[model samples]
Target chain A: GAGVSQSPSNKVTEKGKDVELRCDPISGHTALYWYRQSLGQGLEFLIYFQGNSAPDKSGLPSDRFSAERTGGSVSTLTIQRTQQEDSAVYLCASSSDYLSTDTQYFGPGTRLTVL
Target chain B: AQTVTQSQPEMSVQEAETVTLSCTYDTSENNYYLFWYKQPPSRQMILVIRQEAYKQQNATENRFSVNFQKAAKSFSLKISDSQLGDTAMYFCASSSGTYKYIFGTGTRLKVLA
Candidate 1:
């Protein structure tokens, strides 16, 4: 089976610009997750969507960060007015369900560089 | 709030030897799941092993095993007969019914030949 996939493997933008990263979860996956990993730092939870339930946006660092999952299959993370601090590797993951025991399959990640 | 901690920043073990990575987490949920993930230089995160909070028996996957101390809120991963390919960053995580996971900072392991 194909693993999670992220588009635009690398993106470079200037400060104040907006960028959208895309993620395609495995077929039939009902849960999706987004995380940010800064240089030498741990993964920072961004957001998640589960089936038809409301998405969890509590992990969004600021209002400038937002995400949307369409048809429960694909997800897009958008950063408005990006800052230099926004530069990092953005990773997406998905699982069969939201159960605690389900393994989350990760994507190769999109590295965003904000100058 | 749930929090995972990995005190060791880095560690090294000779090939064919044994190594153990320590992880501790604090969570209020009584039923949850703990996991160990390995991220290689390629930046791919792979699941190594998992342990359920309600299970008393530890989880093991071949050479990879876990010492899960529920009462102490500790979950440590042990790798025996370490191989060069085992070198990577290891992250410990915990998740409950909320479906939100808390991850540790990670421990970088280097397998020496």
Candidate 2:
């Protein structure tokens, strides 16, 4: 794809329900990132994937938040037992490689509304 | 740990005017990168400009430029000849030697007609 792609642009789920968001990064990109944005707040780092290394999950707020990238192309963010506070936009980004100066391209975020 | 901060919550500028957005970050790493991203109603994050901490000269892209102060931990975005299309939420971010990014609370810029 020419740009990063995300699915389920908008989702309204009941509290305690689980939701899965998908992201497809640009071809040949070796680094991927996930972020969460609450209403009127800045983007919060969630996780990072660099090549075949173990993902950097230091930013995950809780055990309910988890993500996986398959074949180094597509990624999934799963929120278990979603809470009302989980209502936010989930963003995904990809970079050519995991370098300090690498520029990241972002996808249209998925807006999750936990009702 | 790294943290970015945007002091201004909202700003307005007339078409053809110039506006500056403020940002500051804290990090102990010496090798790092700074970035400014724009997000319109479409929700796509677009890179506006970037600065390398090691470079003393600022980075500029046409009408967009940045004033990066490494010692003060400040990075600001200046938009010259602002246009109505420039109305959007602007974010400041930083990345250390690692690939993870830390973003600041955005500034909502409204370019008035």
Candidate 3:
């Protein structure tokens, strides 16, 4: 079975620019999540989408971070006015359901380097 | 808020040897889930094993097993007959009755040949 996949495994952008990172979840997966890994900040949950709607957006670090899932299959996380601190690995994961105990399968992650 | 902790920052083991990575968590919820994920140089997080808080017996998959102590809030991963492929950054995580998961800082394991 094909696992979750993310686009642009590595992205290098200038500060103040906006970048869109895409995530394609596995077939029939209703639960999708976005997480960030930084050198200073181990790993932090950015957002979670159950189907096409997001229920918990508190994990987002700032207002500049936003994400959307369309048709409950593909999701895009957008970051505006990128800062140096925003340089990190963006990871996407998906599960079969919205169950809390469901195991999540992760993508290779997009490494964003803000230059 | 729940917090997961992986005390060991790095660990090394010889091939075909056995190694244990320690993990502890703090949470108020009685029912939760514990997981150990291995991320190799490829950068994909792979699920090694999982343990349910309600289950007294630990979870195991092949040569990978977990020592889960609910009372002490401890969950550790043991990899037996370690191979070179076992080298990776291992993370311990928990979801305390929530849709969100809390992950640790990760332990970089090096399986030396």
- Candidate number achieving the greatest DockQ relative to the actual structure: 2
Which of the CAPRI classes, incorrect, acceptable, medium or high, describes model 1?
medium
Q: Worst lDDT window (10 residues) for model 3 chain B?
A: B92-101
TM-score of 3: 0.97
Best by lDDT: 2
Better of 1 and 3 by DockQ: 3
* Candidate 2, B-chain TM: 0.98
- lDDT tens digits by residue: candidate 3, A23-113: 9998999999999999634579999989646457888999999998888789999999999999999999999988879999999999999
When only the first chain is scored, the TM-scores of the models are 0.98, 0.98, 0.95
Please tell me how candidate 3 rates in CAPRI terms. medium
Q: What are the per-residue Cα lDDT tens digits for candidate 3 across B3-112?
A: 99998999999999999999999999988999999998888999999999999998999999999988899999999999999999999999877788899999999999
| Model 2, span B1-113: residue lDDT tens | 79999999999999999999999999999989999999999999999999999999999999999999889999999999999999999999999978878899999999999
For candidate 1, write residues A32-109 as lDDT tens digits: 999999888889999989999999898899999999999999999999999999999999999999887788989989
Clashing pairs for model 2 are none
lDDT tens digits by residue: candidate 1, B44-101? 7889999989999999999999999998999999999999999999999998877777
What is the RMSD, in Å, between candidate 1 and the native fold over all Cα? 1.2
Angstrom error of the Cα, residue A109, model 3: value is 0.3
For candidate 2, the share of real interface contacts preserved is 0.89
The runs of at least 3 residues in candidate 2 whose Cα sits more than 4 Å from the true structure, single-residue gaps closed, are none
> What are the per-model C-alpha RMSD values against the true structure?
1.2, 1.1, 1.0
iRMS of every model, one decimal? 1.1, 0.8, 1.4
